[model samples]
Target: MSDEKNDKDRRGIQSVEVGGQLLRALAHHGHPMALKDLARAAGMAPAKAHPYLVSFGKLGLIEQDPASGRYGLGPLALQLGLIALQQTDPVRIATPMIAELAQRLGLTIGIAVWGTRGPTFVRLEESPAAIHVNMRHGTVASLTDTASGRLFGAYRPADEVRALFEQERLLGKLERPRLAPGTPAAPAPTSWKEFERALAEVRRHGMSRTEGAVVDGISAMSAPVFDHAGAMVLAVTAIGPSGALDTQWDGPVAQALRECADRITQRLGGRPPVPVRRAA
Candidate 1:
């Protein structure tokens, strides 16, 4: 009995090690690969690798192109990645960094996640000279009217953003008067073409900003946080009095906010999208 148990344990460890080698090889390549190449990368004979590939495919960890015979990570891999990202505490990971940024920049910082209602603040850090903006944890940002909302809209799927926009529009219509007494409403987009153009600009800049759009005297700049699958998982935003907050998308505050968002993305094993350079 003892000998049988020891043998089973040895086989289990060997199986895990072999499986890990295949996974590492696929990750190192960063793209779909032919079976021969994949086997070579894993230092295994093609015959030896085929059995493992079949098992991995069965388990949904790898998928093969029917026409090309190339293999890549599959749906289960993406699901696992998203699950891991969800398990990682964004607020816990961002709290200290945001606090440090607030102190260094003398601005209030907030981290928001895509909540059921909208982009909801999960963590906030206030500078000594912070302005009294009516924001807090769980406060849902307006999709059409705030920096954080635009950041989420720009980075997330078009379908999701469109749904949110329709929902907000319906709510506004039902609420009678949407804008307050002295507040001026932002001009509605004249067409879908115009709305997409604005979002494209936001994506190109990798951030968004709003001036007195949410609060009377407040301004904010926001950057997106992504997971390994390139999904926007959170947003990092800095808010302050309109006069103090730099609303320029390329300003120091914007750069700092983007950098902070990038750092958090790295912690979640995510890579930000590479910018495309125009050819001269």
Candidate 2:
């Protein structure tokens, strides 16, 4: 009985949904479309689609070209898109997801966005068994060595990342790594060549991982969240005590992190980029 009621609650107007398919097709194609092509893309007969287009045009949701008879999104659609973009907050949309993931995976989950300096944590959900780390909402992660930072380094503009790295280096921040007392000595400061390789690995796998790089005993994996323009708008990261977190690229934790990021991207009406491929 509950399931049936839920199903009924989830139902929406069928005609509205059908009409939306035309809008979706136009958006997907990203240009004006002929009546026949639009109807075929929307999987409706042209006659059936014509009435919907006429109604949409009347409402300012679509426009038809007088010279070519092509259909395109109208002023109302552009206004709606702009409004949606303004209200789309990746951190707010991702908070609940990361909270649930933190509970399920028994690790810490965080959302980071491009801050004034670099990738800065805006939301953090620490698990019950959380490790003793000194991270908070405003903590700016290291771009060269940390999983969260490397994610931005991988997907963000090259000049921007290079500037940040150069600044950190000049400040002596990247000269030496800080490691936990019992953790083995931190690896050498990353050279440009090494940094490029690290980011390439991240792009190839669609995520980034670091073990004992940021903190001696903590391991983390991060995935990028993109906006409608395919821009890397956020980075979702999961961290925990090193051995306990399963930091392997193909491990369950990494998979969960990527899935969570993908959900956030979809929520924003965004799409994740295809993984980078190496030349044969």
Best by lDDT: 2
Tens digits of lDDT, candidate 2, 73-188? 99999999999989988888998999999999999898889888888888999877947877777888888878888999888877788788778766645322234345443444
lDDT of 2 at 123: 91
Clash pairs, model 1 backbone = none
Per model, state how many residue pairs clash.
0, 0
Question: Which portions of model 2 show Cα errors greater than 4 Å?
Answer: 1-14, 29-31, 40-43, 66-68, 174-188, 272-280
Q: How does residue 14 of candidate 2 score in lDDT?
A: 99
Each model's lDDT: 0.79, 0.85
Model 2 TM-score, 2 decimals: 0.82
Q: lDDT score, residue 256, model 1? A: 92
Q: RMSD, each candidate, Å? A: 8.6, 4.3
Task: Choose the strongest candidate by TM-score.
Answer: 2
Candidate 1 Cα misplacement greater than 4 A, ranges: 1-87, 173-193, 273-280
What does candidate 1's lDDT look like per residue over 59-139, in tens digits? 999999999999999889889878887799766888899999999889989888998887888888886793755566787
